[model samples]
Target: MDYGIWNVIELLGALGFFIYGMKVMSEGIQKAAGDNLRSILGTMTSNRYTGVLTGFLITAIVQSSSATTVMTVSFVNAGLISLVESAGVMMGANIGTTITGWLVSLIGFKMKISAYALPLIAVAMPLMFSKKPNLKNWSEFMIGFALLFLGLEALKEAVPEIQKSPELLSFLTQFNDPGILTRLMFVGVGTILTIVVQSSSAAMAVTIVLCAQGLPIEIGTAMILGENIGTTITAELAALVGNVHAKRSAKIHSLFNIIGVTWMVIMLPYVLDLLHYIWPAPETGDPNKFTLALFHTTFNFMNVMLLIWFVPSIVKLATRLVKSKGDEDEEFSLTNINYDAPLTAEVSILSAQKESIKFAEITKLMFTNLKELLNEQKQDTRDKLKAKISKLEVRTDEIEERIADYLVRVSEQQLSIESSVKVRSILSIAHDLERIADIILRMSKDIERGNKQKSIFSEKQNKNIKEIFGLVDLSIEQMITNLNGVYGKVDISGAIETEMAINALKTKMRKQHLKSTEKKEYDVQSGIIYRDLFFAAEKIGDHVINVSEAVRGDFGKDDEDM
Candidate 1:
């Protein structure tokens, strides 16, 4: 055994190089595709079959099934797609992953693509400095594509030939028997290899290169099966931080792969025979790489064909396997955004938008509770309502901070003009919504203070305050609707009209309060409380209208008026 410690390091380094190139390439394509990629995933996954196609297309374009699966998990986590839809996408991702094996065979082995790596880099370097974001993104893709082939060539050279590593060959030769146990063992090897590298594609490449260096195709095929099982771990790990739905979605991927691998392992010998008969391996240079690639593709395609009919069943099983956290499940958490692995800027903006909508709902509840606090007569009940209002205000502040932080991270990335606008809209909306919560909390405190001082609103004062509360409620409802509705399609006029109504009511109440002050209808201290409550409601209306305006992407339009 001439291979030593440095040889192992060299091999690992080559693997690292290959994985790095793949990562850069995947990110470049994702960035370049931008909103168009999001639009595809959003629109095309209407049904199971279309979802499959969508998954395949995205994985192929990005050159990483792990990326596609994680993206799917994030979507499911965010509630953007249902579990059934995620199942379909995961199925398609399995098939899409085989593209890497084919690339390793057809282009990587047969062609000298690495020879042009330098020239590609040369051309990409100048474009990297372009003022146009699109141009810069495409240039990044070019550089990554070049790096990928160069790394692949490095991998091919770094692998030790079996003839040169007789000890390793002798050990591997024991697994050459066409027995089920040997097949299973190699499958385990493949799975471990994939996991160790954290990339099924890289694992597949290693299997191909090893086979090319004289390892039997049967062993190589078994390893490929293991790789299939191993790739699902990435999605599973990604889902760990996600919700129960996310966990279920990742389970679907694992179950699909595990079931496919189980049947394939049983039928491995026969399947290999069939492949050999259909596409005979060439005599020289371990030609079974093509056969292995074909088997990878055919196995996934057949698995999908057989299981697409049982997607509902798969979803049911996944649901059973991963239970929800019950009360915690419905708590206000970041369902849409996964800060652990930030998606593309466009996709992230969509996540932030959903979170903002939830924030709007929280704001609505805070105001609703504030109204309850004012009219709540029982001291115990009022204290509880006040406590709840305070808690909600704190929650709104935390939500604003998190969403803003996530958006700021998204902004740091290269962004399109439209995505940039979206980020700003969500930020402004989140800020205003937080402000509304603050105002509600302050109003609740004022109401509590007046109660402690033996000052209460008269019947007429209560009635007028209720009228203004009704109007503020209307404005909050509209704010929520706008947050959930389409951005450009927001009916700003209705929101503006609501703001005007709130303003008009506030003015009317002011006049009435002054008249009462002159007539001594209520004590000065009570009048001051009434003035504070109505003015706070008016301030809430201002913020509520600001949210709707942000939804319309109309920032700074009525700032002076507000």
Candidate 2:
């Protein structure tokens, strides 16, 4: 009866504390286990079922389904996983999130763990300041674990006892009427609560505390269902900056949860009776939150069981709902990465690697465009090719800048030895790819200028150019294969052979060009263009070798190439 504005402030403060603890704990664990998480997501999602299990394991480890979903969206955006696989993972994440409810119920309500909060902080202090990254990360996790229980304890003290406050009890009871409308209204309440908090786990914590403080079990159950639907908002928001596939993956998460919740709401009364029959509410000590936790787990587990078989159908619906732009060019956009959230060093480096591959692929396209420009006889077609090459060149510059920025951010984090090497290697590879694009654009410009000035090449000179173009294509193809292959597993012997052939061809072209110029076989301007073109192709070959070297983790060691 004495509840006031300060009580509301205390309640809000406790909620913020709980949410912050969840954030810190989740991030700490994720940063510590990032590589393992990447490995799991990459290797285990071969099918829908495996993806679900992968998602559940990851969510359970990190203790937040939102983090798992966001990571899933990132992977989909990177083209690392398929839509059906993502659907399975999202389903698994739903079941995994119920772990938090059970934790709060079994530990927070049944035990006085908050009594150890201060002692836990004291123990973590030394590790928090450790020079080792792993130690420091785990220390943060311990501190977060302590703070979560402390926040829960504060929440218990902040909420007024519903029994003593007859007025408040009367207000809450109005929504506890045994009707479908009552359940639906409470579900809406839970949904709004989760959306406002941006954390289903935190919302579940609040719901558990309320139930413990005399709120009805049925009302809490409805809210838990709403929280399931609410949690999908994280994935949707995460996919906002992603590509079409990422959006579709997120759509499947929303569709799955909404459909599950729809069926559950209709079955709410029967489910409640069954739950009560199975684990009747206790009359004593901190109202039985176990039933609420049980409902949370069973609902999600059953939902996954019912929906796993329909992953393909879910993917189809999502794809139809979120259509790709008709003219979307994967190379022209940074589809593999986003800056919306802070990613661990491992995840960040992986994103940069994928983007760098796209950067290399773009240079290959520019080379093809240059060849097209050289062959086009019509003035209009040549102009168009020139414009296209110029556009791609500009885009390559932008892509390189973005990848550099992303890598720099990744480098700022505490990285393992391998990840640090990868960051540098990706940076070097991106630089070389952008340089190749520059060379291609310059060659295109030279050809355009020659055409404008009526500086026609001799048959022999054209043949040499065609031959060099073919060699360069071979080199670029090898570079891409190296980029796509596992790091440090590349066979640069093929790249070396191609590079040698290119160099030998460039030397031969130079010798023939000198003889032609000496004999006045063509104008000095035409001879100069031929030499420049061959030299540009040779330079691209050099950079392609550099890319292969970087892929093999042998970058910057060879002065001749570097």
Candidate 3:
């Protein structure tokens, strides 16, 4: 407290830059890897050990266990990863996180490293100036690493001066008189900092560096505990914007970390003693930061080892922890179509395309409800069908929002050239799908409004409309299903069939409209509703054709206009 106020300001400012730099670095790494990290982690389901390794590699590359866990939770929500599989990945993430601690440890003590840090700036500057995104990301990594070391050095240098201050020394002495409550408080501090920062690696990195530089063990351990709790905040925030399953996945991550940290805190003295025993180098002259890094790594690895067998239990616990207080919101549940995972978002898009088709199938139920409205003469039955149709419409809107949001998040991220193209195609198709949703809603409203006027399609008109609408449904189903397959792009023989049939249907419907008009089939109001319904249906088909074309890579004129 008695240290120079200016020095204190400098220390805080340096630490702030360090935290900020780590953030930039972590985000760059994540954006660079994008969905590829999810894909890699998603593949490790059969073997627990393999999953552990996958998790580690992904977290190491991503530079944040919280990000990895949240991504894993997103995957879980999408049904891409089983709970058991996720646990293994989570385990690996813990161990992988140690890489940063080791990296920080290397940077913390060696004064000569700062010389290289300056060279990193020189090397990175050009890369930052380059036109390439990859190069920019490389620069970002460089600047982040440099600032990280710079901050740690400032903190270490600042600490020894504060060591002479009575107020700070007394504060350190108060915590050093350790016991169970004190350790829990320490864990509490770690959890709180991690929660606040949403970055476990940052918290851990600082803890290792500070402890190695002689911040008392009690203080360092408290901060580490806070880091674990803090990591969960990232997943919690992500899940809030996500669905129930996503929330549950985050819950699993948080629960597991809490469990690990809780037990570790209870066993604090013993665990710290174990680390000291395992690596006797820390107590020697010029304390080894590597020892701290090693301790963090092993503690998490051992926790994962101890708990992985109980994955099912953890899953059950997480589910209860994240229980829905009411019925699942259909809109969010419908989002089983996950576009972002450890795998590339594009690959996830392909996977989501399949899920979208299922949504289409669910959509066809709207037609069935419509048909019931047509056949039933009773007001009660009609009202019930109308309500059901309305409910279905609401569900579709929710689905569209969920999808658009997910894709939007993916869109904002750095994507590969190929992935970017795929995303464009996917976005185009999603637009088409969303348009179809519009047509469905319009159709529902039209039928209800038309029914109010008591107008029936004449025999010939009825037959033609049903036949054409049936074809429209068939084409859309095929289009959505084949979107990424041979049927999706290129003239998968069906393209010709689809184009011809849609054209014929359009022509046939046109003639039927002419005949209805010639016959003076109904009142002006009835005719207007009929015409609008027919026009809406045709437009839906047109959009479907365009989507299919977009899927097939026929994007020249249309996209250029946009």
lDDT (Cα atoms) of all candidates against the true structure? 0.83, 0.83, 0.67
Error of 2 at 94 (Å): 2.4
RMSD of 3: 5.8
Which sequence of candidate numbers ranks them by TM-score, best first? 2, 1, 3
- Between candidates 2 and 3, which one is better according to lDDT? 2
Off by over 4 Å in 2: 44-47, 74-82, 129-131, 170-177, 241-246, 276-288, 323-332, 335-338, 342-349, 372-385, 403-429, 450-471, 474-512, 519-526, 545-562
Residue 227 CA error for candidate 2 (Å)? 1.7
Superior candidate under TM-score, 1 versus 2:
2
TM-score of each: 0.81, 0.83, 0.74
Among all windows of 10 consecutive residues in model 2, the one with the lowest summed lDDT is 327-336
- For TM-score, the strongest prediction is 2
- The most accurate candidate by lDDT is 1
Total backbone clashes of candidate 1, pairs 3 or more residues apart or in separate chains: 0
Q: What would the TM-score be for candidate 2 when compared with the true structure? A: 0.83
TM-score of 1: 0.81
Whole-model lDDT, candidate 2? 0.83
Instruction: Compare candidates 1 and 3 on lDDT and give the better one.
Output: 1
Cα error, residue 472 of model 3, in Å, equals 4.3
Cα deviation of 560 in candidate 2 (Å)?
A: 24
